[model samples]
Target: MSKSKRLMELMMTVNRMRKFTVRQLADQFDVSPRTILRDLQELSELGVPLYSEVGPHGGYQVLKERILPPIAFSEEEAVAMFFASHALRHYLFLPFEAESSTALQKFYYYMPGDVRDRIDQMKNRVDFLTHTRQQKAEYLGVLLEASVDQRVVTMQYETKNGYSERTIQPVGIYASNGFWYCPAYCFLRRDFRLFRCDRMQSVANDSTGIEPLDHRHIHLGNWEEHGSEKPVYIRMIVDLSREGVRRCESELWHVPHMDITPDGSGQLNQNVPSSELMYFAKFFIGLGNEATVKEPSELVECMKGILNEIMAKYD
Candidate 1:
């Protein structure tokens, strides 16, 4: 590595560990103590805020709260960061757009010449889909903060049936289909619920005096898939046609056991609790009439109701 690069790496090591003697640094970098001291002096002169302490435990340390200069990135590193930021820019609809653009510009400007040349050569070959429009950025920011802080929020949510005011403690934010969703514990229903971020008419941080629930008590993903209800096994018979086999193999649905006969006819046996049966039903709706629930009277009724609704639409 170049002297500047080696010095930058040493600076990072020292910053993370909080203290390192010149001898220790020399050993780490495989250099002489004199070279380590010279590098430290150069770094200090470059506004790195490195200080040396004297005594039994004395070593060089970057003072806390000091902002270090940006490290140089290789051409590959620059391109990778750019691509990551580009992907986020497309998927994330938030106030981060300007920040992402500025960071990308600064990265490209500081990158070494050879690295920059490689990035330029590959730039045209890398492109992402741009058809999707940007979403409200502030909503995402608020949802993220709520999830991290474990704070409750009050929002007016628009469901397919109608609108309702709700107070919920957000557990996490996830993307499904093309929209963002906040899975939270709803106060009104006294259960976990998923709220579409965009469909939220109004959202505000709630500071009212209510004891925050312990997040560890809830299974957020399972709650989102199947409410707080206990799971019950539901059996499904999936046809083993080419399309059916491929569909069952998809990660989107969880099928525990599937048996295929010599004739290509297959039985897909899934042990889904009542909690996730609705999700399974919604997923299988795309299979037309080929996917059938053979057992669990409740699930059969649910599927029949859904099919009835679809048939009604045609009638």
Candidate 2:
């Protein structure tokens, strides 16, 4: 095999075995012990973090490091990451665009010549669907940095009513529906909240030495789970005749609890906040009478109001 391919195989061996003696690696790669040691030294210089121990059981191992040297990607792998990153550039908006671009540049630069050429050709041939214009901002990165550093920040937030200043202890950054959101504990509100990064006007580090809040209350995966004092039970009845029973059985909507009555009536039970319950109600609006909110009089009223609004639009 060529030296590059041999080196790639050696790296894979080192990663998989965790520790391998020079003799063992030499035997596996069908090379001399001297050559194996040389290869390990080369990888170490390239930032592979391969370390050797001396004794009877001594072998080489890779030390865990936060930042390691880049790995060799096949032509297909390079193109896949490039396309994925390219698609993310549109949705991530501000800070991620520059960051992903820089990372992609580094990836391209380090790729083998043939793979790099193939990626460049693919990039020239592929075109992404252009997105609508968006307001440019940089606070996403700032919030991300603060979250990673576990630092407190004071920022001006724009809410539906108006702008308000807040002191927040940021816990994590998340993305939902093509927008960036920071889940943090707001000192002003004295509760955990999700804030849209695009709506933030200004952010500055506050060195007031505020303790990091417990993140147990933060459910970064689902925003609906946060900001609720009482869990509201929402039940829905879906007609299998109009809506395919197969789709409901597929669990597309992520309903946690559900039941089917003997008479073929489907019941969905979920403990969600009022806002999330209403948000989900809109999804069944076009189903007409085929979908119905069965419980929580408030949700039934909300769905009725939505149906009324739709009727008004038609009128």
Candidate 3:
């Protein structure tokens, strides 16, 4: 980048931040500390109110009461923003979906007609293939608000057994596997748990105030990252033939235990939750004879039982 462009961005970055270090600036800009020092010197000469403290825990800070002016986007930036906004619209259930849409629309309002035309062309070229939920999660917006305000929420939620009431302190809301899930501190369970937004029947905030969710106390983790969720099924291994591996490449990923030989045959060894046994059974059944069970006689028997049931129906 040219020095002028770098200087403008450097001022904007520093103005937008409360505090930053020379090392942080260097890393962010992919330059050396010496270059950052030179840039800082130039910015200082240009009357940017940058102050520094010399200590083990101290860094540079923008002088108090500074709000930077609005930034103008280049044509490339405007086009990229258009593509980004449309691409993210369908795929993930984001907390800031409404704000994001408004921002995207506002970005186009002041744009040059030529730049808007370029972005329109880019929008036509880009497409994201994703699944849309049949049921709308209207409570997601309310849940997001409650989480931000640190309010306790009382909810009637559907569970495996039946609907149950819960008083929860929502920590984070995330979307995975095509569903929006909120990780919260459940007062009933006295632990962190994930509550599916779609499974929420009714939700309302309690008037009582609580400490807002803090990053220092929050630990976001799930079964894929931790081994603490109880193992629900015996470890099962299934060897796949060459053709089977070819057809199941995408399905085999994210299973946690998978191996493949140079010849293309592979083995998938992982624990399946009993709740998903029928789903996995159907998956293996679809693989036909190309898949062979290798261990955990229970899985083999389960497959045989499913097969027997199918045969009985046919007979």
lDDT by residue (74-103, candidate 3, tens digit) is 778777777778777884456677778877
lDDT of 2 by residue, 50-98 (tens): 7779898888777764134336576777778878777665563655667
> Each prediction's TM-score against the native?
0.59, 0.60, 0.60
Summarize candidate 1's per-residue lDDT along 141-245 as a digit string, tens digits.
777777777788888888889998888988877664446778888988988776778888888888676666777545445554546655566555555555666
Ranking by lDDT: 3, 1, 2
For candidate 1, which ten residues in a row score worst on lDDT? 129-138
C-alpha lDDT of all candidate models, in order: 0.71, 0.70, 0.75
Structure candidate 1, residue pairs in collision: 94-137, 232-273, 232-274
Worst 10 residues of 2 by lDDT: 238-247
Q: Which candidate number maximizes lDDT?
A: 3
The per-residue C-alpha lDDT of model 1 at residue 191 equals 83
Q: Itemize residue pairs with steric clashes in candidate 3.
A: none
Deviating ranges (above 4 Å) for candidate 2:
1-67, 92-95, 109-137, 207-209, 214-230, 237-269, 286-298, 310-315
Model 3 spans with C-alpha error above 4 angstroms: 1-69, 72-77, 91-94, 145-151, 160-162, 208-216, 222-279, 286-296
User: Which residue runs of candidate 1 sit more than 4 Å off their true CA positions?
Assistant: 1-78, 92-98, 113-137, 216-228, 237-269, 273-282, 285-315
